[model samples]
Target: MKKLLILGLLFSTGLFQACTVNENPQPITNELLAEVFEVKADFTPGNSFRNYYNLSPVIFDSDVLLVYEFVGLDKTGADIWKPLPQIYTSDNGIHQYNFDFTKLDFSIFLDANFDRMRLNNSWRLGKTFRVVIVPGKFAKMVDKNNLQNVMNTLKLTESSVVDLTI
Candidate 1:
């Protein structure tokens, strides 16, 4: 009877020693699960025939591509919008590139006689641009210049607009 009691006590002691309690436990945090990016573009007025601008991806993954577009009216007297030729940049974080405004080609994006070269003039100043990030896989499968396709790839859930100028 004494031996059995000692063995039971030892077994209970072992079980108690084997138990564990978490220490300094950190609470689990839930963040939105999605592909995200931070985009930036600086439009600087240069000359009538050319301009200089800085384009960059502030926060993005290497497997993604950044598409920059020039958005404005389709024509001088038209209400329609036209997305000008798209410029693509790699996924280097916070890397800025200077593109010669003189090299801008609008053969496909603009209507005939819509002079894109003149966009560097003072009248065309203060234009705010946008950037869209797309997966490299989508870059190969879809046209990055198309906003719809980029939205699809980004899995856009919601969007909001804010007017800071006001």
Candidate 2:
């Protein structure tokens, strides 16, 4: 018992010494974090079905614009991805885009292997607009098994209406 107690005490002391908290913890400012990419989808009847062939198909459609924002983060909550400046468009309604970290004029935290992406913000505007994140191929690459699960966990459906000029 005496030997065990001594060994445990020595191990604990060494562990505590090695893991010291930062006395002056640096704040994670917006500059340190990467910009979030904003994806916009226009649900116009004529043009909606056109852009679908190149990327993914448009599963749902309404007379509205659906916008979603997302950024990458590390396990410890550090920003790992940067947002791209220009928004991408598709001829068909079903369009997909990502935050190109390489194009952003900032340093990235995560490498290429970690393809996990998320929707941090979303919004819609129309007579009756509703935004939803449907499970797609991106789910398999996410940390969670289900893409819908991540959307539900993050509450991606929560959205706001914006005023737009016709």
Candidate 3:
């Protein structure tokens, strides 16, 4: 009986020790989880040609980049943010604001059916853009087209935005 009791106690002790959780665990840091940046482009000299903007902290190849351009104010006096690949039509021609990104950098350019130089200042100059870095883990869950949806899912707000424009 004594031998059995000792063996049972030993087994119980080992099991409990194995199940113990680490109390002073290191923090789980994923800096690229969801980061926001506000960038401004004048598109002066680059407007006539091609230009690329480098992302400050390089992102992982698995990460996703989302870009939004500030279009204008709404009726409620609130600023409107529109997703990129935006197209504009006017007398000048059909103009598009498109962008491409790699793990190291991202670039925005004006694409038009007409002369690129003919694009109006409104379409080229003084543009504010929001760049969001989302971890690839959440890529499938996010609606990339809807800015509001992306912001909501990532729990990001204007307060969380880092102003790279300055």
Candidate 4:
């Protein structure tokens, strides 16, 4: 019994020693952090009903793109962003806001169950969007549908976003 007690004590001590806390723990930093951009543009639905924009600095093939629409301002007057493909049911029918991206560029478009022309012209003009480029590995770790979750996980804020006009 005494031998067992000593063995357990030694094992506990070893475990405690192995878990050393750093006196001045360094802040965790990622060299390949995500990038964010705010794009303000108009979607001219001609024959195809799509508008494409080029990525200034080409992203990696493994990187994933998340696009959000600026719905409006909140009660606090802060901009409200919602992840796409967002769907809305109007009096006419259901309309959706969505996007697709490659390593070089991305396109945003509107689709509806009803005739898309029936939708208000305002829906296609003067639209704001937020684009997030996340590393493929990081995307798997967060709720991609949650803008706040992705922003927090990527350590990005509105101030850090680069603005582009299209």
Worst 10 residues of 1 by lDDT: 102-111
Judged by whole-model lDDT over C-alpha atoms, candidate 1 comes out at 0.38
Worst 10 residues of 4 by lDDT: 40-49
Q: What is the C-alpha lDDT of each candidate?
A: 0.38, 0.31, 0.80, 0.84
TM match of model 2 to true structure: 0.22
Lowest-sum lDDT 10-residue window in model 2: 101-110
How do all models score by TM-score? Answer: 0.35, 0.22, 0.76, 0.75
Counting clashing residue pairs in each candidate, in order, gives 0, 5, 0, 0
- Per-residue CA lDDT of model 3 for 37-143, tens digit only, reads 88777655544544577876788899989989898889999878888889988997798787899999988777789876677677677788888888888889999
Best by lDDT: 4
lDDT order of candidates, best first?
4, 3, 1, 2
> In terms of TM-score, how similar is model 4 to the real structure?
0.75
Candidate 1: stretches off by over 4 Å: 1-42, 45-61, 73-123, 157-166
What ranges in model 4 sit over 4 Å off?
1-32
Better of 1 and 2 by lDDT: 1
- lDDT per residue for candidate 2 within 1-166, as digits (tens), equals 9999999999999999999787998765422221112223333334421112111232322211122333445689743322222143333222233221111121111112212122112311121111222233333433343323444443442232222222
**Candidate 4 lDDT for residue 107:** 90
Question: Taking the tens digit of each residue's C-alpha lDDT, what string does model 1 give over 13-59?
Answer: 99999999999797532112223222233233234323333323222
Segments in model 3 whose C-alpha atoms lie over 4 Å from true places: 1-32, 45-49
- Which digits, one per residue and each the tens of the lDDT, describe model 4 over residues 61-110? 98999999999888999778889899999899898889999999999888
